[model samples]
Target: MTIYVNGRFLTQPTSGVQRFAREILTALDRELCQSPALRDRLGPIEVLVPQKVEAPGWRRFGLRHVPGGRGHLWEQGALWRASRDGVLVSLGNSGPLLHRAHVLCLHDANLWEIPQAYSARYRLWHRALRPRLARRAAALLTVSRHSATALAAQLHLAEDRFRIVANSAGHMLRLPSAPGVPARYGLTPGGYFLSVGNRSPNKNLRALIAAHAACGSKVPPLVLVGGEVPGIATQATAGGGRIKMLGRVPDGDLRGLYEGASAFVFAALHEGFGIPPLEAMQLGVPVICACSGAMPEVLGDAPLWFDPNDKGDIARAMRAFAHLESGKRSAMVHSGQKQAQRYCWRESARVLAQAVAGVPYQLPAGKQAARGVFGSESRPVENLF
Candidate 1:
């Protein structure tokens, strides 16, 4: 079977979606290649990727040579043609062709929920493309049960059409705490709370900053890692001490920050599946996150929860995490570690391959014609094994 995976997201910085695409594809290529069940049922699998990506190491899953230009027109055309042979799976927002038997990994509906987080042009593009992509998809994949439910509710998609595959921590599972990292970032050792992610409006960073200031002297300094620092407003506080913005730290440094922090903080108003909190958990750091979207689903009772809308609530959560005794902190860390183990890339790949292999070749009404290069399934769409 030929599987064309949209690898565009892989080019982005290491984040939830990029990591998902890269890790899952790598795992599938390595593990599924030797699976007797997959081999016997699906025959030899052919994976297609963008041509510009290097194929020697880590890039070999599928690279194809599509012309690079404005608006991704050439790449989309290439994907459409390549997908003609068999099932196509898009790992991001964009889809390849109109009528192919395809699977779409719609990570979240963040654009619709928080339009202010994105620019007008981005929102317009999403509004135009998302519905068409969702309607055309043979099966929809999401990063969390929360995301699955949200997509179904927002897009009015049938429950059975969606598949929930949670995101997992990357291969760098753990990071040892380095003593001088705090000093390098001009922070006291074990005297700061860590927050990581892009500086988009949905991150609710302004609220976090307000909450951190409201905590007064009891809470440690707030260290924000990742995203470009906005030049418009001064992030520094009234006392000249501000939320330390360490924009886009290297992976090793990020791990150090996570390990050495008093607690990990996430203030996002929405997320498909929050991964940074899980990463912090693996690093033995206690987490404090907003009690909404996939945050509660991902963290459960493992992390300290606060309402994103209430600055006082966020401050309270921060103070609680900051003042917790060593024994209590240790317990939270252990619980978080156990919770983090629930997600894995290998299982994600297995389920994804199953979904793609099981999709019927016959295209549905208003959907594109499914080329019969692959055999049909005797079982119903809901009952495919």
Candidate 2:
């Protein structure tokens, strides 16, 4: 049967959610190229979006834009009618509430877990909408096992209702080396530390800044990426230019940033599934990740870990990572690459295709059996990698 994708994510900006949608769709196209079995089971994958709005990467996939409403109105009106007869897949957070054959990818339970971190309006909308969507959806897709567990617990639903399809760093892999991009950012390979994300409180940016300041002037300058700056301007300025804010950057520039950094630092208190660490690992950059949430489960032992809550611990971890011998750093890079390979966009697409094709659930293929791939635990339906 033909699967219609909810094109709402196309109207959104290029954040983690949008990135996941784009990468997965591109990979799904590639997967279809290699798997004739999948082709027989699933018909043409089509995306239905609203007309007149510019969708940056829509041309990369099978896009069909219908003229009518915009935003949620379009989703509820045109999208609902378009997806009435087929399986509708909403890769991002939201979907039409009335659709029953819909598969919704709820990236995380952060809205429920850390309600205070989100604005009142966004939190209220998600709180009201998601539970109902979860109940109505034919199946739920999430990025990490941790998120699946957290979402199941928070929604008071069975864990089998959710499938864990992890994210991949394939988009940044094998890119043309961006020589000028690094120069534009005033960075040198292996000369600076890096962190990316918005200024949300849950990102713990202030704590990361505090940790950088405590590390003293001898450490490499800490570079903050993403569009949101938060309240760190004063502190960043007072540190005698120890912190460099690059603001939002283009996708092409990101690979250069990852390749040039001494180590990537992710201090977020919670993530549905941490992507930056995998991005860094894919580019052969060492990573320092927070011990909270899914960092441990996703990155495995490939990264140096620290407590997101304790500024001292973060500082200490950075310091130790900086002082690691060359031999050790190379070892970490090798191990990280192996860990990064465990996740692939094509694999994610195959699993999603399986779900869309109404096949029985199964874990993503990996280093071992589904049981070992998902860390020795099997769920009622099937374990997700």
* Highest-TM-score candidate: 2
Question: Candidate 2: which stretches are off by over 4 Å?
Answer: 53-61, 228-240, 359-385
Clashing pairs in 1: 49-62, 49-63, 49-64, 50-64, 51-64, 51-65, 99-368
Q: Global lDDT of each model?
A: 0.73, 0.79
* TM per prediction: 0.87, 0.87
Best by lDDT: 2
lDDT of 2 at 213: 90
Q: Write the per-residue lDDT of candidate 1 for residues 48-113, one digit (tens) a residue.
A: 545455552543254665444423464457667766656678786677646368788898888678
Question: Ten residues in a row with the worst lDDT in model 2?
Answer: 230-239
Model 2 lDDT per residue over 74-114, tens place? 88888999877667899988889888678889999888777
